[model samples]
Target: MTPPDLAQRLAVRERPPGRPVMKQRWSRLLFLHWRVDPDLLRPLLPPGLHLDLHEGAAWLGVVPFRMERVRPVLLPAVPGLSWFLELNVRIYCHDDHGRPGVWFLSLDCNQPVAVELARNLFLLPYQHARMRYGGELAATRYHCMRHGEEAEAVYEYGPAPSAEVRNAEPGSLEFFLLERYLLFSQGRGGKLYSGQVNHTPYPWVPADCGKWSTLPVKWDGLPEPQGAPESALWVDHVDVHIFPLRRLE
Candidate 1:
């Protein structure tokens, strides 16, 4: 396995050749992450993946965002099916090929069609949820309750007062968390697949997160995190281009 070095991290940001298969706009993204022991995360990964750590500490994130204009390249966005709210529980990981990416434990989306499509077509673990998002960028609120789960995940967040919007600097903790371009998923027979997405580096600011829940992380069977997130970042918007998944060699 290759180490996730600086060059490898930067290399994935390049747009791949060929046409993208889908397009999306992700907005009002709030990323809340906590540093955790790598050992706690190791057993949760599939056989081929290794925890992709920063400073020897694994990171887990609970991200809440709004997805708009999501549709296949050749199709127009359908009004009802296209837009939705999503909250995902994820861990940073790298495959044997040294590709750093997200490994989602559970992705909770409001649209049932989207949940089915993602689970069937992309092999991503998408769960159905009742969700709502409202308020302005400066002060937003999001809530999610996955099907069959008793507790809800709620978040109230916005840009930190007077914080400047900028890209994450290389080798910084922010870069390690927000600059990912690839995602790994497990398909049938325990085989792994990878997909890519290309977008300009996030223009983000430190977030003033309030009243957030650790229930999403607990729902995934992980131990609950104590205290507030070690890092919280927010971005108002980004246009994303998604490529098809390819099986790993």
Candidate 2:
């Protein structure tokens, strides 16, 4: 879902002779997305997909997913909440030639708090952690942040937007946006988990949210499948994160 033209579009298109070009730059936030098949997930989705939700956290743990949006856009929106947020989750797979993999990326319009946190806490030298295979994405439960791990954070998804998503202090979060997505199913629990990555951007620079970042996500649950029963039954929800960082401007 990485749209190459995004950054280019952010550059000012028209400006007088030597005037400062005002571009619509991102607010130094990272995002993640996932798309699943309804048919495949129907049999797998536990009856209790919604168990406990952390209101203080962000985004609803289970909702709808949109398929049409690009990668960067879907970074903050809650999964399975809308057509714009849902997408086919892709995993990094290497071909015989050792190339990139396939996966999905959601848009960020609904998630405001998590997006803000990422902008504030997603610090420099981006970090990554892999479980080979672990966790349940279909079932809505509080994600384990793994105590003692500063880098590990708990993620939740749902139908509504986060409680506190406004940019309380503008220009607080800044960094390079090195975003990546990986999808995998837990071999033990048959739970699907998608890995979303973000690194510090171009060292770091503080920027205001009003002019730099994205609009808060818009939540809309999935519509009834129009294609076929198989298609409708296979889709499960997704797991995502908005990774942001801080650095000197």
Candidate 3:
């Protein structure tokens, strides 16, 4: 399938009008992506989404980040319930309307309440995991292991260099990976749904990695990632507003 037009994709950045249902901050994110054949990902998607490709290659990402101050729109953040660590194995896809978004294979978080809420309300594949984060700004370490499973990943990363910090050029691979504003998921009773989140374009920087592993992807039923990632990026922070999920009729 032809990739969505770059200009059209980039044009959909405006926040959908209305009060958002949720608010949160995603910080210290490490994005690791690998290029794969589109055919390998087709069957895994739900009924209404088409695998989104860039330059004819499908991309899968493993993102580990700190999730903070997550709460419903009008509610105050509750201590233990509001913050946690998250690791997701995701792929790029576009819905029937040609709106590109993420399709999560699994979202593992340290908070069980958040896992249950996401699984039941958003129809996402969320799992409870034991997770931790430490180290300093220049170098950070992340680790997670899903309950009752061998799925886990451990890695440390830091910024690439001063020269490598820049915005993603429009239509570039970096833009394709980091600019997504929508997410698609399969809801209860096999219904397909989409949710929107708005955030400023990521202040992306090339990143260097140490002691990385692809166990999360393997746990999602895909083959182990081969070789080094085609892209590794770090975004220090992005505050996000999440709209309510809507059924795709």
Candidate 4:
């Protein structure tokens, strides 16, 4: 199997044009987690990766409204008892041409079920992804996370190919822009949001990132896929509406 070539793939080379200089053409990630699973935990986290899901209970992230303005939304900072948040992250190495390389999931908790879902999200044996010159690149839906704080997840995914499982398909996915809308009660914060699928441009991202936003949703009904086992399972998705979405202007 093509074990992820972290060294070769992540090695930073001179910035190529059309891509960001030093760091460019990548996606920004922001996930919130409280309790975590053993298998789904990272040794360390990257900085500048934080979300405030306290004040405004937004559906997705800071959904930009005007152009450079965005509203404030609170993130679930409470641990245990009734707080669960997860978001699988994907940052691309944008290029004038060809495909980008990136993948990850972020969420709260470190439960066994959550770990399993995260594992399945990014990992795909051998399926080394290779994108043609011109074609769709993103995926359809985000990782459907189940269980946790008992909240429904409503999220979406842009068309972007990964190095492993769930790569590009036949047709191209399309995204919409909700520059002006309502989020919970934060009121139209005079910001803007442009949704793009399959064709979302890549921004600049750091390779050796300290903190990340990718996380996974676990199964509460099933007894930790390890020591014991059961049936029932809960699923989740990228609920951008839950959190406030803002453009990185």
Candidate 5:
């Protein structure tokens, strides 16, 4: 299969032909990624997808963020249902057609309705979790414990004082990891499906994440990650437009 070219990467950012199905605000995102052995992840991917590598290495990401204003198009945000926290364990991947996207192993969310809706509507791996978020801009704390789990994933992070805010360079590893706009999921009968999300390019900075956990990755049935994460970035916020899921075979 051909590799995803810059043009293809840019193409996914273009608005789809129809109206967006939902609008959401993703804020206070902390991205923690580790380099994983490709052999370990290959067996976990659904059929038709290959691991998307950067410099011959496979990457896994653990992202914890706040979700706000999550409402259907033309609908107002419901006070309780629209606000929540989520933490996802994902890997970079590309379909046989060479379209890059994220393949989630597990998505832990605090809102029960959102979990059910995403599982049924988008075919994602959404799990109900007890989560909490708090703290000021300079310092933040996030915690999540999926139902039936004996331990919780906790994160305490803040901005890296010397790091600067900027968009990732086009051909850099940062761009490869943060620029994904598509996602792949397995629906009923193990059929494949794809969904697209459009948002401004994320402006990221190094994170002073003194506390991070690898439980989410282990919870997904992968080998436990050792040592500190190779990369950690922070994004204050971004408004996103979510499109409908499409059948991919």
Candidate 6:
């Protein structure tokens, strides 16, 4: 299948009509990515999604962030239930229709209720975990251990020097990694689904990270990443609207 034009892919900024199914805020986020062989990832994606690549290389990301203000569209946010830490191991993919999105191998969160809702409602791979966060604005530390599993991730990150926050340029690696607007998942019997999300363009900043591990990726069956990550980025925050999932025909 022909890939979507770069302009078409990046033009997805408008929110869907009617009310969103859920609302949330993602803040204090760090994105760590490694370039991997496309062939190694191709077999892992569900049907209808081809591995999305940039400059002839496929990429995988491990992202840690805080989720806040999580609630239904018209409902009040529940105090304790609405906030938590999340870490996900994901890869970039685009369907035959040329829609770019994230394909998660696993999404670990401290909130068990959120994990259950995501797994059952959206058919996502959501796992419960024991997690914690610390540090100031200059540096942040995050840790997570998946419930009933040996897999975990621990890392510290901060903004890089001169970490100017701005929109990523077209055709750049940062654009490829940060501009995705849809999420693809597979349900029972291999039925594919896609959920749309709308948020303003990320004010991305270069990031510096230390004391990191690739346990999540390795636990997902990929080989451990070697050496340093190809890219490390930080985004302060973004208010997100999540639409209901729709079955892909």
Taking all chains together, the TM-score of candidate 3 against the true structure is 0.96
Model 6, span 31-70: residue lDDT tens: 9999998898999997799888887899999999999999
How many clashing residue pairs, candidate 1?
A: 0
lDDT score at residue 64, model 5, on the 0-100 scale: 98
Please provide, for model 1 over 224-246, each residue's C-alpha lDDT reduced to its tens digit, 9 standing for 90 to 100: 99999999999989999999998
Q: Give candidate 4 misplaced runs (Cα > 4 Å).
A: 1-139, 157-249
The lDDT per prediction is 0.92, 0.23, 0.88, 0.22, 0.92, 0.88
Q: Which structure is stronger by lDDT: 1 or 2?
A: 1
Clashes of each: 0, 51, 0, 77, 0, 0
Which candidate order results from sorting by lDDT in descending order? 1, 5, 6, 3, 2, 4
State the lDDT at 165 in candidate 4: 20
Off by over 4 Å in 5: none
Summarize candidate 3's per-residue lDDT along 52-143 as a digit string, tens digits.
98888899999999999999999988999888999999999987777888999999899999999999888899988999899997789999
Candidate 2 residues 48-154, lDDT tens each? 12111112111111212322212344254334332222112222221222212122222232233333432333311111221111223332222211212333222
Error of 2 at 73 (Å): 26
Q: Which runs in model 2 stand beyond 4 Å of their true positions? A: 1-102, 116-226, 233-249
lDDT of model 5, residue 3 = 73
Per-candidate TM-score against the hidden true structure: 0.98, 0.18, 0.96, 0.18, 0.98, 0.96
Q: After aligning candidate 5 to the native by TM-score, how far in Å is the CA of 99 from where it should be? A: 0.8
